[model samples]
Target chain A: MLTKRIIPCLDIHERRVTKGVRFKNNIDLGDPVEMATRYYEEGCDELVFYDITASSERRPIDLEMVREVARAIRIPFAVGGGITSLDDMSAVLLAGAEKVSINTPAVLNPELIEEGARRFGAQCIVLGMDPVRSDNPACPSGYEITIRGFREYTGIDALEWARRAESMGAGEIVVNSVDADGTRAGFELNITRLIAENTGIPVVASGGAGNPRHLAEVFIKAGADAAIVAGMIHTGEYSIAQIKNELHQAGIPVRRHW
Target chain B: MTAIIDYGAGNLTSVKLALQTLGVDALITSDPDRIMAAERIIFPGVGAAGAAMESLRKLGLQEILHTVTSRGTPFLGICLGTQIIFQHSAEDGGVDCLGLLQGQVIRFAPADRRDKVPQMGWNAVSFVREHPVLKGIADGTEFYFVHSYYPVPDDDAAIIGQTGYAGVDFAAVTGRENIAATQFHPEKSGRAGLQLLENFLRWKP
Candidate 1:
């Protein structure tokens, strides 16, 4: 059976895990490697590490932090943010990341997605879509996709962009909701479902996970292959073990810990 | 020493780092001499079939890899590296491959009931046959995967492990003689993934 994934995301800046409300008011969490290893032990299916400061600083991925996390954990890790070129993707993959997540670079140069996918294989390439709902009545249900941590709007429809990404060879799409982020209300299931339904690639729903039931609802209702929980896990509100147990009881097939 | 073949494709760092974590001395190089001289070779790749094959030809590594594997030297192909072992790829409008294995790589059919391409994330696998590559690996172990195309072995007996996606059972791990390849990234698969790598290291054949 193809099981649903329960992923824990770590937003890293200067090698430390951090999170905030709406991508602002950043708060330091703890060492990324420690948190990653803990998540792995607690039965998280996989981990996503976004070098949130890399793109803003106009630099390469933090290989040091990547190496530390890779060395400590045994789970698959996806590294994102500031991955602009094939060289950047190669550097991070060599540094211990299983997959490279590209956002602004991929959109800026659509060929980069094709080239990267061709060079490394689509499976190694992941496209990150940070979407914010638009107020314009014409595009009510549609949202504006943001890049570089919500600094710039691509004016591209989220669902449309996700389909384009799949056509361009993105193996997976990380549908992150800017509106529901940090609110802990729940995941933006409508947005996630829209993307998942429109494409064939696995969809990982990010942002607004308040509890285990929230994760379950996202998988069961929205039909996401995985639900990414950051704030809830980082704040120690819910442990991954408990969440997996609850999800299992709720009929979601998650990887069980030995 | 283990030499990881680098053809300017995807990252070889994580594979190298994983080898280092296991206290194994490894090197990432495109040099044919070094690659051929290494005790074992890891054909690690993460890119498209056409470009990867092109880079291999550009670096003159195709023959070297053939020589090493032909001599019965241990060879492990990861992801695209595993796919290129076939005769050709349908990606990029058909590309010639190393022809190490007989078959053609094709894109996965979209979900019958409207599923997505590029099946990503952690998925489970069932071992097909007993082999050193999967030694100590139990059934129902979930390994991470990210790809749209999968290998169809010319010799069905070569397949050592299998995983299903969208109702299709694809080859997860295929072993023949000294050549062993995995569509999944064992380095990124966590504990079970690491254990699989360890088994590869200890494989005597």
Candidate 2:
């Protein structure tokens, strides 16, 4: 049986591990490789890294960081934030990332999803979405896709786009609710369940996990296969072991390391 | 030297790095001769079986791989590598594979198993029969896996380890003589994965 995945997400800005509220006002954490090693040591099931270095230059992803992190940890991880082309995807996978996630570029040109899946296997591509609250009749999920780090609304219905992305060959989807993000109220269960219920691919629910109980709720109620956690673990609120132990006590099948 | 076959597949570097971390200096090469000359060969895969076979044929490595494995050289195949070593696959609409073992790859039927198709996370691998690759690796230790198709060996003797996905048992590891392959990627499986690689490094068979 496959266990419920508990992921610890981290941000990489200017080649260093950084912390921020949702997506802004950041402070350096430390060396990404060191942090990754510590998390892997503590039995983090997986890691989701976001290169939050906003740039207009069309540069490549940080291959050096990918290699360093890969050398440090043995678990699978997904890297995102400037993956604009298939060549970039290949480079990231070659640098030892198990998967490459596309956000804005995937939305701008949806064909890239099909092509990336066609080139690298669908298992290597993750569809990341930052959605905000919406109640438009056209949007069934009542959530709209937001880009540019949650500043711009695309008017695209979150659930509809999620179905389309699955049909387009996305092996997994990461739903990070902008409204629920950094609020610590918990994941937007409605939106997360909406996406998870409709798509056959694994759904990773990101954002607003205040504690381990929040994760248990996301996995049990929302039907998320994995949780993209940050703030709680980032702020030393709970270690990966403590969180997994709590989930285990809740009768959730989480991998036990210690 | 152990050479990891790179047929334009993902995780070639991770396999090499895992080998390095295990203190075994392995080489990542697509050349046929280097692969044939290596003391041990690790074929790693992360894509479709048909395309991987195409890449192998394009580089003229299919025959060399067959020759080396049949000639009693230790061979380790991961994921698609293990699937391609079988006779046929249902992926890409029924494609023929290397036929090194008596098995066929089939997609996980969710209705039958009631589990996710990809099964993309840590799962317990129980040893059916002990082999050197299982050295120091505890039984039922979870290993990372990311795939939709699981190999169903025609002959039960070749299957060494089995993993249950939603109550359906599938061959997660198989071996016959010198050829040993795992459906899981040991490179990406953390400490336990490293231990398997270390055992493979010293595997006499």
Candidate 3:
């Protein structure tokens, strides 16, 4: 049986781990390498490090930080934010990360998804999408794709983009809800379910996880293959072991050993 | 010292790092002498079969790999390394592989959207028989996997373990004599993965 994954995401800013509520009211954390090592040791299935400010700053992800994290942790991790081209993708992968995610650059040049997949194999390419709820009929799923850290609306239907990206060779899709992110309410089940049920690839539900139940809801209700936690864990409100034990009791199969 | 063959593609750093964490000395190299002279050789990579094969040929590693296995140096293959060791691969529109083992690699044709193509995530491996490298790992212990194609060895005797996914029971671990290959990435599989690597380090076979 394939166990559902519990991944801890580290939103990086100036090489420090930071968490903001839906991209606002930023709270500085600690070093990424240290945080990543802690999560890995705690039995998190994977880790995601997003350079939150890199895309807006028009700079590539911090490769030195990536190298540090790679050397420190043995579990699989994905590095995203400000990955604009194939060279960037190669540098990140060669620097030791298992997967390289593209959000803004992917929307700017959809071919980047295809090219990255062609060059590095589909399993190495991850598509990180930030979608917010919208009533516009253009988005059949009522969720529109947002870019540049949720500052711009592309009017592209989230579900449709998922299907297109899959066709273009995206290995996995991280459906992070902009509306639900940092809310501590719960996952936006509507879009996560919509995309997970429709797409043939693995869907990682992100944003708005307040408790263990929220993670369970996304896994059972939304059909999410994995879920990302940042604020929930970073704030020390919960540990990865605590979360995984809760998931295990909830009957969700999660990796529990070191 | 263990040699992790570096033909330019695939996740080599993590493998080396994993070994180092196990307190084992491993080197990522393409030099034939170093790989052939090492106590063990790990042929690990991830990419298209055609391109991987091209890199191996360009670096003159094909013969070295064959020699390593034949000389009983205990060779282990991971993911792409496992796929290319087979006789042929359906990837890259029918690529001829290293042919170190008798098998054919085929892509997973999932019936619906529920079963993804790449089959990324952790899945359990059921032991079909005991092998040194996988010793002590319980049956149904899940390991991380990220690949679209899996190898079907010509003889069932080569299969040491099996995993079911996409409505198919495939050979997740295959071994015969000094060579063993896994469809999953042990280096990225956390504890169980490290255990497998540890077993490999101590494996006299």
Task: State the C-alpha lDDT per candidate.
Answer: 0.83, 0.87, 0.90
Per-residue lDDT of A1-258 in model 1, one digit per residue for the tens? 567888899998888888988779999999988888888888888899998888989988889888888788776789999989989988887677778999888888888888887777777788998999886444445787888778887777787788889998888889889989888999999999888777877889998999999989889888898889998888888998889889889988787633
Give residue B170's lDDT in candidate 2 (0 to 100): 94
**Candidate 3 residue-wise lDDT, A1-258, digit = tens:** 578999899999998988888788888899899988888888888999999888888887799988888878778999999899999999999888999999988998999999999888888899999999998789988999999989999999999999999999999999999999999899999899999998888999999998999999999998999999888899999999999899999999876556
Candidate numbers sorted by TM-score from highest down: 2, 3, 1
Q: Which residue ranges in model 1 land beyond 4 Å of their true spot? A: A51-61, A81-94, A100-125, A138-142, A146-156, A164-171
- Please provide, for model 1 over B120-200, each residue's C-alpha lDDT reduced to its tens digit, 9 standing for 90 to 100: 666788888888877777787888776778888888988889988877899988868998999988887877877888888
The list of candidate 2 runs beyond 4 A from truth reads: A55-59, B112-114
On lDDT, the stronger of 1 and 2 is: 2
Best prediction by lDDT: 3
TM-score of every model versus the real structure: 0.87, 0.96, 0.94
Candidate order by decreasing lDDT = 3, 2, 1
Q: Is candidate 2 or candidate 3 better by DockQ?
A: 3
For candidate 1, the C-alpha RMSD (Å) to the true structure equals 3.1
